[model samples]
Target: MDVSCAFATALDSADNIALAERLGYHRAWVYDTPQQSPDVWMTLALAAERTERIGLGPGVLVPSLRHPMVNAAATATLAALAPGRVAVAFGTGFTGRRAMGYGPIRWSFMESYLRAFRGLLRGDVVEWEGARMRMLHPAGHAPPRPVEVPILVGALGPKGNKVARELGDGLFATLRPPAFMTEHSWVAYLEWGTVLDEGEDTHSEHAREAAGPGWALSLHGAYEFGGPEAVRTLAGGKEWLGVIERSRKQRRHLAVHSGHCVELNAADEAAWYAGGSGTLCEVTLSGTREAIRRKLDDYRARGVTEVVYQPCGPDVQRELERFLEVAKSDES
Candidate 1:
């Protein structure tokens, strides 16, 4: 199975990219969230310049968050910088939009947005706000030039999967079984968390943590970061008050069960961190070389073409080293 490294904007330093390249990672993905990370395009450019062969792209970007024209332009620029190595994945942007006070967009509108975005990437003219905009350069030139940047679609359910099959170059999903992609005849990628060590106890603990039930605080923290007053205005007095009450209750329960001292207001933060770490460990091929090889073999049996390893917690450089060692072992 092919292995790639996944990272958020938090770890997109030049040093990190250079190390990942030397370590034999096939790709480096950057998460696109406004409040928590650096700009995706800028980070991709930096990564591309720092690495020679590792493919770079946004793990996924919200189509509804930006106008199609803007996305087309940004993607075109990135593709030019990296030539054949750039790719893009588009999603509905539920969390991102909510963070900006906008409700979730309908799939129909999102589909149209993706169509236009992809069209522009293929050097076709796209209609935007009654004006037609096409790439304005020659075949080999930048901007209007043609570049084969694959577009992957992030789909979590049946309908979304169908759309991905119809429109995307491949499937990009998280927390889903590989069978989902195999059933659709699309190349499958499983997003997993992994560490480089081989301690059986550590791997077992990580597996358990991955299996633990978790809550998705999509609205709470996204809204909180959007702004305190904006959240009040969007959620209103009654709904907002209800969320506050529920959050408090959930926090108390979590604190009691987890044996941690944390305020009700801090529950979202805690859950996010814990879930992130768990996800990193669970999605990756970890443990001893033999154990990791077995895990990868299992995924290959399930028809997974690529497994993206996202390191949890800080210390990204150390994780990259560990991951590189695993990759080198597989090569041998």
Candidate 2:
């Protein structure tokens, strides 16, 4: 399977994109959490100008965050820079929506957005939100807006996947192969965790710093689905639940996602103190390089066309080098 890297979006993101290009990563997907980082389009535009071949786009675009014309215009600009390398992924805003105490957008709205956005990309004037809209960029201004970038959608369940089949060119999903997937589908599985250093302790401070976000996110997902009882499955889960519970200042969501995807928050760091630390490695791609390689083989065998690995922690360069090294190990 092809391998790609994603950053949680930062000011120095272009430098990391340049590194991913040099290290042979297939793409660089920058996150779109407006509350947690910089503007996704601006960051992507910078990465596009700085690199030559590595693909670039928001990992998943949140429909509620912008107008279709805005998105279609930005895609034109980035497509101008990268040509056939841009991929537009539509998703229900996870942290981006939830931090504001909102939930995922409806699939019906997803269908409408896709129609409007893709039509504008094709230079077709489409009516949206009460008026006709289209990209009017002059020849020198942007790519001729019959810009044909591939579209992907983030979907985990039947409702969402149904929309994906109707709208997107590919599927952006969590680790498992969704039931609808066939060998012909372009499935990109999003994975998390760090490749453990040889002899590194899973519970060590260094390991937590490297892989805590993946484990903590698991806790976050569980708690979102099953509440306090759910997080009790992890080490400090019970206590972490208490911490989040007591902080229900009508905005407990703010605390629940403080360090999402990028690093561990105080509540996240607390949950890794005991035997449960091993769960961090067990649940994610956090194993030795060989272990990760075999795990990747298992995914590729299952017909995953790509593994989009999101590496966390302070040292992005090391994370980038380690993952690419593991992905290319089969050739050696």
Candidate 3:
């Protein structure tokens, strides 16, 4: 299986993308949360200039954030900078929309947007919203249209999976590769957590800092897809629900995803510090080197072609180096 790296997208993050290229990560993906991080395209653009071989793109873009023509243009531009190394994935908005107080987008809208976006990439004029539009970059401005790059679909449920199956070149998902996927399919499974020290506590301060944001995402995902009731079913779910309900923000929707994959907010830190560590290994791919290697093996068995691991906390370089060392263990 191929190993890839994903960044939470901080300022000066191109350094890490450059490091990933040196470390041999097949692709480098960045989160697309504008409110929480830098612009995805701009971040990738920097990475493109800094590195030559490692693939670059947003792991998953929220369709509602921009017009189809806008994204089509950005993709073309990134391809120009990175040549054949650019690839992108799109999804119904998660934090990308919710951080702005909107709900996740619908599949119907995403399907339509995908069609229009791809059409625009092909230099075909297509209808979006109420009017026909196409990329109008004059010659010598952007990469030539018909800029062919692989587009993946980020999904975690049946509806989104169906859309990916029909419209996308590959599948990008969190947690596990869906059972329906096969080895022939291009599946990139996004995962979180750290390679723990021998016998180290999963809830230790370091672990909490590195894995907390990702664990918090489980709560955010549950609350987003299944509501408060669903979040109540996970470990420390009840207390987390309380944290969300009592958030100072007038709109709890925004509070639910405050830290996202970057850092743990007060609510996220509290919940994980309270008892969230108990299930860290259960929900996330965080564990020891041996354990992580096992998960990589299991992923390949389940049709995952690439493992896009996103590290968290203050020491990103440390995490990146360690993950690459272990991920390459299978090679030796």
Candidate 4:
């Protein structure tokens, strides 16, 4: 399986992407949450200038944030910088939009956007809002027509998967949704967390502190996107919903960030069972090296062609190293 690393949109994203490439990762995925991170395209341009050979792209860019023509232009510009090494994935706004107090873009909008986006990438003149548009560039000055960038769709359920297959070259899935594994295209699974070393305490304060944010994001996504039935099945669904409701009512800042990045109220951390003893296996992989290895194998068996390890902790470099160590040993 191809192993990749995803970075939050921070000041050091290009540096981190360079480090991931230097440390033997096959691909580097950068997030697109503008509120918390830098501009995805600008950050990617830096990544392109810093590295060669490693594939680079946004983890999943939100479509509602920009017009289709603008996205096409930005993507084409990035592809011009990196040429054949660029890959992009589009999603119906999640963290980006949620941070702005909006829900996901309508699925119908995403379907239409992906179609026109793909056509533009292929050098076809496409209609947008009743206007015909195409890239205008001089020969040898910009990336040639049909930039050849692979397009992937970020999806969570069956309907999303259908749209992905219908319009995208592949699917960028998170949490190993079963439907994604069975889909007829490339699948990249984004998993969060760190692997514990032999002497490290898997349940220590440091571990819990590192994992809490990812766990919170997972719970938040489940409640917001998974519908009532899915939320009802969560371990502490009732209490979790209460916390979310209160946060929304209070209008608290809900963007995920670098350290202890849980997007919920700090006080209600316990309500969602985000204490040191909570089970984060539902959102992240925090365990011994061997156990993490087994989980990677399980993901591979489940049809995950690429594993995008999204490091969530204070020392992200250390987390990346630990995961790469295990992934390298799997080949041994």
Candidate 5:
């Protein structure tokens, strides 16, 4: 499977994208959570200008944040720089909205947004707020007409997947594969890390800390959208149900991004390391490099085409280098 890097979206993101290309990563997916991130399009434009081979994109843009026409224009600009190397993914806005004390866009609205957004990207005139509109770029300076930008949709549940299948060119997901995947859909499976070196602790504290973001996200998903029953199946659900309950009672899902979610209970961390969703075993590539490769083989068997590995923690460059070194070593 092809490998991509998903960034946490910082000012140095363009630099990281350039370095990722040098290290042979296939692409760079910039997160769209503006609450904790810079403008996605600006970051992508910078990356596009700084790199040649690597694909550049917003991992998943929230349709509710900007007009589809605006998104289409920004994507065209990036495509102008990267051409066939560009793709954009859309979602119903999770962290982006919650961080603003709002909720995800309704599925109906998201479905309509996807249709309009995909149409605009395909060079079709689409209906806007009240009128039909199409991209009207200046002659010659315009990116190629009818740009074949691949549209992906970030989805977790059945309804979301259905919308993607109907509107998107592919799927963007985390950890789990869809229940049913069409032959034409490309699945980008987002993983937390790829740490294979054997150490004193199989699930080291460093590794656990490296995976904290995803673990914290899982808690948000389980408690908010997935319900208490889903939360119960997670690593430390039983032991930390009280914490989860308290958070739920207080509507803590609103603070689901970094600088807040990472301040998790210690018990939750231990449970995640023990085994369950968000554990190194479940969400990351951990073990010998050979073992990690075998795990990747399993994903391919299940229809995963692209593996987007997201680096977590403070030392992102170090973690990224370590991941690429192991992946490259295996290729040789």
Candidate 6:
């Protein structure tokens, strides 16, 4: 399994990028959240110049945030700088749009945007205002345009998964199980962290604190119980109720502002973390090194292509080091 680091734009610095590269991480995934962190494109550009072989990309960029033409141009520019070391993962505006105070766009519109974006990247003439625009300089003179850049999709539900399978070169996901990828033959690149050994208490504490309660609750529930019921069960106190109430308020505010109807409740959050249809934790990899290895082996046995590790919490460096140790170990 190839190892990739999740560059938390909010927490990670240039030093983190250097550390990731030194730790033998193949890629650094910068998130696209305006409120959370730095600009993903700029960060990736800088990271490209910083590291030789480490690939850089947006874990998932929102189509609604920028025009397809802009996305195409930016991606093309990045590809020019990094050559074969860039990947673009596109998704319907969820986190990115929410963070930027933009409303969500329809799935159909996202599909159209991706089609146009891919066409532009492939050097095909895209119809814009009754005019044709093609990539001025193609990767090389080849039948398919030799850019060799892979377009990944952030797929969660069946509709998203179907879109990814139909249109994307790979699938980028966080909470979704590995079985979904196996069923579709899409590359499964999961996002989360793993810790092994002890004595890094300060680092672990930092990571946990940085991860926050929501992230920890989600991860704990996902790994332990497989679905929202588990999350609900684990968060059965007033603390969880407070979070649910806050989410409801947020949903109400969202509805008032954007008029987008969304189910908001503890159950809704649970359902989002758990598979919408049912609860299943058959593919979440967490816990100790041996346990995680066994879980990864199961995923590999099921034909999982990749597992991207995103370290969360307060002590990111410590968690990163632990993740590296596991990656370098015999089981990995």
Residue-wise lDDT of candidate 1 within 1-332, one digit each (tens)?
56777765654454576677787777777767664566877888888777788888887788766788777778887877887788787766544454444555667776777778878878788887788887676655564555577888777677677778777888776654535767544343634334434444432444323312221222243343454454344322234334444546434322222211101124333443433323333433445666666676666677667777665444566666665566557657
Q: lDDT (0-100) at residue 2 of candidate 6?
A: 68
* Candidate lDDT (C-alpha), each: 0.59, 0.83, 0.85, 0.74, 0.74, 0.60
Question: Model 4: how far is 216 from its true place, Å?
Answer: 1.8
Clashing pairs in 6: 206-314, 206-315, 207-313, 207-314, 207-315, 208-313, 208-314, 210-313, 210-314, 211-313
- TM-score each candidate: 0.72, 0.95, 0.95, 0.89, 0.85, 0.74
lDDT of 4: 0.74
Rank list by TM-score: 2, 3, 4, 5, 6, 1
Candidate 6 backbone overlaps, count:
10
Give the poorly placed runs of model 1, Cα more than 4 Å off. Answer: 98-104, 137-143, 183-190, 196-265, 268-291, 327-332
Model 2: per-residue Cα lDDT over 1-332, one tens digit each: 78998888889988899989998999888888999999999999899889999999888889999999888888888998888889978889877788778888998999999999989989898999899978888989888758999998888788788888888898887744676655237888888888887998788776787778877778788777677787897778886776787785687888899988878777776676645577876678888999898888887777678788887778888887888888888446
In model 5, residue pairs whose N, Cα or C atoms come closer than 3 Å (at least 3 residues apart or on different chains), thus clashing, are none
Rank by lDDT, descending? 3, 2, 4, 5, 6, 1
lDDT for each residue of candidate 6 in 1-332, tens digit (9 for 90 to 100) = 66677765653455677778887887777777665567888777777777777877887888877777777777877777788888988877555675444556666776777777888877788886467787675345322453557888877678777778777888776654645776655464655544534433312433223332223334333423343344444432223333444546445323221211111234334433443211112222445666557666765676566667766554667777776676657343
lDDT of 3 by residue, 1-332 (tens): 88998988888679899988998889999988899898989999999999989999898999888888888888999999999999899977777888888877889999999999889889898997789887889987788788898999987778888889888999998854577667237988899888889989988888888887787888887887788899878777788778788866568877787778878877676668668778888778889999888987888888888889898888888888888888899557
Judging by lDDT against the true structure, name the best candidate: 3
Relative to the true structure, candidate 5 has a C-alpha RMSD (angstroms) of 3.2
Q: Local error of candidate 4 at 99, Å?
A: 2.2
What is candidate 4's lDDT per residue for 20-79, written digit by digit as tens?
Answer: 888899999988788777798899999899998789998798988888878888888888
Clashes of each: 7, 0, 0, 1, 0, 10
Candidate 6 C-alpha error for residue 314, in Å:
4.5
Residue 274 of model 1: what lDDT? 38
What does candidate 5 score on TM?
A: 0.85
Candidate 4: stretches off by over 4 Å: 199-201, 226-268, 271-276
- The better candidate by lDDT, 5 or 6, is 5
